[model samples]
Target: MTVTSARFGYDDLRGLITRVVDVKHAPEDSTLDVLWTLYDRVLDLSPERLDSPDRDRFYLSKGHNPGSFYAVLAAKGYLPDAWLDEAFTAGSRLGGHPDRTLVPGAEISSGSLGHGLPLAVGTALGLRAQGLLKPRIYVLLGDAELDEGTNHEAMAYAGATGLDNITVVVVDNGSASHGWPGGIASRFTAQGWSASEVDGRDHDAIEAGLRGHHGTGPHAVVAFATSSI
Candidate 1:
């Protein structure tokens, strides 16, 4: 049920993803393909206008591993290539996790799990309040993060408020201590949000899941990996 995304052209994107990662900081590998598809295909934000109020916002809620997030940012020209060189080194801006103040395109500093989705809802609401309805809000979260009560509150509010401009992509790698009973997508759909699941490793499927919903509510795309979660 993969829906085709609206047309958007990209060049040398895989090459750019490669340029941002190295052996020492290779934890980003799992998210490389998905992140690239978002930055290179779906999201409408850019590095030049990091301060633009009209720019789409992406909040990385799963900050435990930001290698892929950093890679996507660098590939999209949000940070200099040299930022990779000193990544994780002493006093480096690019540390174990992402900091919005340090990274040009990073909208918020993330680390305390389960905080991103709630923030994304606020961002979308704030945008709507400002009469800037065109800019969409996106938040990427780990499947494990959904176990938190904060995410539940956020999704419920978004669904009730018809926050259709927000998109939540849950990277399900089966790492959650308490696995979801039915499915992750069901949780969102139950709360009145449009929901879908897709192959996490396939770029086409991921993009489609991200774009499938055409309703007047928020969306949830659960990218399922071959692994447990």
Candidate 2:
């Protein structure tokens, strides 16, 4: 169930992260800031409106280490703060990878790389087909995940189709085995996407980069961090 009380602040996030024990994998430390910025400022989603057709959708494609994602969800009151204590345990719904069926606010079950963006593309198309154009589709991806061929296909398709309702945030920790030549933003721009690059740690820059898209086509924001998670 969703909580209706006042949401926890940034200060409470560290404590929430510490609640999870025996976590085999943890999201990039940089992801904490990005997740917080989205939930706290950018996203038009809340625990109370999970079922709303007009609510925006956020997919976490970089779900190998979901500790930060869980913390953000807890802070936003989508999941009880206490549930975090049992994360990854046998009895807990929270796991190493987020499950949409188990988590209150998760829009998709994800862990395998390269699937989230494709799924978001399909979702945007589906929503448009249903005349539900108010909801935007947002997906978070890791820099390394871009190496997947499937993601390239999805990116090309979304761009060619003028999928303006879609926004992709790529946390670039510089972990991609084969890095882009002109940088990540160029990859998207070449595919007809509106793109921007920003410091991953700067909340204002991140927000600006995300909002910079003006409904031309799909937008991609590459958040560069100093180190890999």
Candidate 3:
């Protein structure tokens, strides 16, 4: 039977991810609370409608490591709970990086840097073209991932075109090799996107940031969350 992550608390969920993933990583820890909040409270998604035409989409654009993504999928009933334990084992479908073909509910295959945002823009545009504006497209990227030129072009286009259905959640733990000047949210704001910075671990704050931009163009949430592993 599929069990919802809501049945368990933060500590239990965190521990489950750690035990399944085995190794500690900052991006995972920094993004854990936000991911939990999105899957458990914000995103209109579930295991039942993985192939539905009108379902919302989530893209893990920062594809370097996806331990939290995998764990959240397990906790949210998108996959078998037993699969989490087999993550990274030989022949296991779960790997350090997510593959859309192998992972159900994975919107983007997301192998290289700076691909998710552009692809997400296309998805949002296509959805709108199909008159499916009710669905939301969310892309999760890292502070470091923003350095890629591909993301810059994508964000600029989304903001300029007013893709209000797109929401970007940037897990900012200050890991960028060359940090963004004048803060991370400023980048989104300058591009005409509604942007907010909040504590990543604060579920309430994260939820607010994720949902506060109703008609304000493309939205972005900069989660200055914990940097520890």
The Cα RMSD of model 1 versus the native structure comes to 6.2
- Per-residue accuracy of model 2 over 67-163 as CA lDDT, tens digit each: 7888889888898888888887888999988999998899999988999999999999999999998888889999999998999999999999899
Give the C-alpha miss distance for residue 113 in model 3, angstroms: 1.4
What number of backbone clashes does candidate 2 have, counting pairs of residues 3 or more apart or in separate chains?
A: 0
Between prediction 2 and prediction 3, the one with superior TM-score is 2
Relative to the unseen true structure, what is the C-alpha lDDT of residue 150 in candidate 2, on a scale of 0 to 100? 93
Off by over 4 Å in 2: 2-6, 21-27, 227-229
Each candidate structure's TM-score, on Cα atoms with residue i matched to residue i, is 0.87, 0.94, 0.93
Task: Give lDDT tens digits, candidate 3, residues 88-142.
Answer: 8887778888888888768788868899999999998899999997889889999
C-alpha positional error of residue 136 in candidate 3 after TM-score superposition, expressed in Å:
0.7
Clashing pairs in 1: 174-229
Against the unseen true structure, what C-alpha lDDT does each candidate score?
Answer: 0.78, 0.86, 0.83
